[model samples]
Target: MNLKDLPIDAQPREKLLARGPAALCDTELLAILLRTGTAGRGVLQMAGELLGKFKGIAGLLHASADDLKGFKGLGGSAKRAELIAVIELARRALAEQLKERTVFSSPDAVKDFLQLHLANRSHEVFAALFLDSQHRLIEMKELFRGTLTQTSVYPREVVKHALAVDAASVVLSHNHPSGSVLPSRADEAVTQTLKAALALIDVRVLDHVIVTQGASLSMAEKGLI
Candidate 1:
């Protein structure tokens, strides 16, 4: 059915006016971006079809203009215009996401800082957050990961890696698929061993954190770090 053929208040344009832009669907949102459509289709319908083909924003971001232009009614210029619009959407999404880590004072702050990025990961990931003497974050690096139950990491290796990265202080973190935030016995042993090694190198071991699906535990808060 034609967009304009719908009841005036029931149309995307009307709903947007009544309830704001958040009330709009993906297609409706894209229609706002497109402004106009080609052939007999309305912009909303074309956008709906395009969103279906591209999945959501992620899939759309991965699509090239050439691929988009191949869509039945999309011309090269139309595809290019839509792609430019999509790029802006991607930029806004990134901009609205969590800010870069600056300083990590408390364990809760560190977990809260990282949980956004870590919570959605599919596999176990070990990250080492590097810090300056002031405890301000310099950067973080993924150290290593094991399949399940264990990671074959070494304390000496941790020290070696820290030295290579020129890190003065480091915070260790790992995820648990089973949703238990408690550190395993092996985790305790490895952390202590790494602490000792890093101590010798004059690099500080700030904290070791175990993250679950919903909660996280910090060894530093428990005097483990």
Candidate 2:
């Protein structure tokens, strides 16, 4: 679609002015940054190619600027700017999701909130979800990263981060890069270790969640702790 041929006042920018910004998706917003495209491609086409190259929005957000620099037209400063914008959009999305979260009402909400942010990762990251007295989410801090079976999640550090955030409780969460929701011995051990460690500080350990592609396992639900 030749955006320019649609007339100056009828372009997406113009339509957005006449309507609103929520009318666009990630690719559409990216197309706006692209502005123009190569002879055979439109802005949407190029934007789609960029997203496809990285997999999806999450993958694209996680991709490094240098890696994106390899794309023929995506090289140089303008391309880097586009890449930065894409990641910024994701950051804003996650930040917005966290805003005004006073406490977690249920296990399902926690899974829903973090699932997209973690599902695409290839490495296991132990994350601490800080919660206030009411169980609302305060912040999510990454404590450690490792392979499938060896990820070292330190309970002390998790407690420390919670204390720093003035959190009254915490939910431990991690992704199974292999797409298995089953908790291993290490996972159970870490959970018990963390539960005990948090007890010393008087901070409640709400749950330990293992997120997979299709579902999540909560230690609390499984009676693992």
For candidate 1, lDDT tens digit of each residue in 1-225? 556667887677778988999988778767766666767987778888887886664446546677677886676585577676767665444323312434553545677545534543557777777776666666666777764333476566677777776778888888776767788887888788777888998998888877765578889888877
* lDDT score at residue 99, model 2, on the 0-100 scale: 49
After best superposition, candidate 2 residue 92: deviation in angstroms? 4.0
Candidate 1 residue pairs in clash (backbone atoms < 3 Å): none
Each model's lDDT comes to 0.69, 0.74
For each candidate in turn, the TM-score is: 0.55, 0.76
What are the clashing pairs of model 2? 102-136, 103-135, 103-136, 104-135, 104-136
Task: Assess candidate 1 and give its TM-score to the true structure.
Answer: 0.55
Evaluated at residue 109, the lDDT of candidate 1 is 60
The parts of candidate 2 lying over 4 Å away from their true place are 6-26, 96-99, 105-117, 148-151, 212-218, 221-225
Consecutive 10-residue window with the lowest summed lDDT within model 2: 98-107
lDDT of 2 by residue, 158-184 (tens): 777877898888888889989789999
